[model samples]
Each structure stands twice: as C-alpha cells, then as structure tokens.
Target: MKLDSAGLQVLSPAECVELLASTPIGRVVFTDHALPAVQPVNFVLDGTTVVMRTTPGSKLAVAARNTVVAFETDEFDPETGTGWSVTAIGYARAVTDPVETERLAHLSGAPWSPDGNDRFIVMPIRQVSGRRVRVRP
Candidate 1:
C-alpha cells in the first residue's frame, strides 16, 4: 500500500476514477463573484468526465460555464475510521449541442429533481487525486 505524507493511503488515478464512478453525489467548488463556493450535486462519470444536471439559469449552471471547477465525492465508515475521498479538477462547460445533450440525458435515469433542471454541465477529469484512511493493522 502506498502512503502519503499525511499517513493516508494514496489512491492511483485509476482508483480515483473508479471511486468517482461508484458514487452518485459530489460537491462542485467554483468561483462565485470572485469568492469560492461549493454545492452538492448529483454527478456521474462519463469516460473521465464529471457530468451533472442543473437548471439553465441556476447559480451553479452560470458559475460553472467555461470555468475551472473542483469536484469531490467520498464515503466513510466512522465507526472504524475507514474511508476514501476523491477530487477532480477540470474546466466545466454547458452542453449546447442538441444531439449531445439528448445523449447525456439517458446516462443517468431520472433526474434527482425533475423541475426544469435539464441542462448538462460536463467537467472532464483533467487532474484527479484521492486518499484513503489507513485501516487499523
């Protein structure tokens, strides 16, 4: 097992991608009026791209357009102190092409909230890293 300076198990790039695919929800960090903001969003991994759905005029939809964003997802077992976290950084863009949008719509079945949240925000996984808490020996 590989460990980082903080004593956490270092996860490989492939591992990180796997973890990202295993989870359904993640937090997206983006710049909001020159300040940092984070929002929990439902996402899916599409060949190394983080895909999320939001309303067309929503804050996230606006802020993430052609902007660099940080996405993160993780799971933990607090009782045993075992868990893993994955973070991916990339530029996000809204899906404007009609054909592409239609294709992505079928990726995840049923939107979490079907209230006019049909726009797709895609963030390609350009840089990713992950870490796992060291399980007790």
Candidate 2:
C-alpha cells in the first residue's frame, strides 16, 4: 500500500465520481447573509447536473439567488479505511420549464419539509473535482 505525507492514498476523478454516485445525499454550499452556509440535500446526478427538490422558503432560495453555488458529496467505509469526496462548482437555477419540471419530477428527490413542496432546482456544474483517501494498514 502506498501513502502520502498525510499518510493516505489519493484517488482519481473517476474514483471520486464512483464513490459520489454510491450515495444520493450531498451538501450544497452557498453564501447566505454574507456567510457560508451548507445544507444537506437529496440529489440525483443527471448527466453532469445535480438535481434536487426544495421548499419555497428554504435557504437554497437565498443561496441560489447568486446563480453560482458549490455542491459536494462523499462516502467512506471506516471498516475498510477508505473514503472519497467530490465537489462541484456551478450555476444553479430553479427548473420552471414544464418539460424540465416534469423530467425532474421523475427523478428521486423527496421534499425535506412538511409543506409538500414540489419545486425542483438544478445545478449545472462548470467545474468538478474530487479526491479519495485510503489508509492501508
């Protein structure tokens, strides 16, 4: 097993995406009230875009107002001493087109609030990067 100065092996982009796709929950980071805010969201990888659902008054409504946002996802297996993380920086927009709304609705993200919201947001990544760490005993 090979290790870096930090004592872990680094993973490639393909590896990172593979790990990311293994899970459906990710963090959306954006500036809110002049500070960075992150929220856990349920998302699906639609080609290169990340699609999720949110309520009307949610923080996403504010963060996404700037059009640019950072989204990330990760997973790890402690028992195996391995993990990976993927981050995407992109432009986010509310999907309002009837065709897009219908298409996104078919994807798997459920509302996080009790108000039964049906709004869909799409984040189209302009740049994507990721890393993985593995500690071999």
Cα distance off (Å), candidate 1, residue 90:
0.8
- The lDDT per prediction is 0.87, 0.74
Local error of candidate 1 at residue 132 (angstroms)? 0.3
Which candidate should be chosen as best, given lDDT against the real structure? 1
Give a tens-digit lDDT track for model 2, residues 20-54.
67788999988888888899988888877788777
Superposition TM-score, candidate 2 onto the true structure: 0.78
- Using all chains and alpha carbons, the TM-scores for the candidates as numbered come to 0.90, 0.78
Residue 116, candidate 2: alpha-carbon lDDT: 37
RMSD in Å for model 1: 2.9
Q: For residues 1-137, what per-residue lDDT tens digits would candidate 1 score against the true structure?
A: 99999888899999999999999999999999999999998887889999987778789988988988999998988678799999999999998776677677788674343454588899999999999964543
The runs of at least 3 residues in candidate 1 whose Cα sits more than 4 Å from the true structure, single-residue gaps closed, are 111-116, 134-137
Worst 10 residues of 1 by lDDT: 108-117
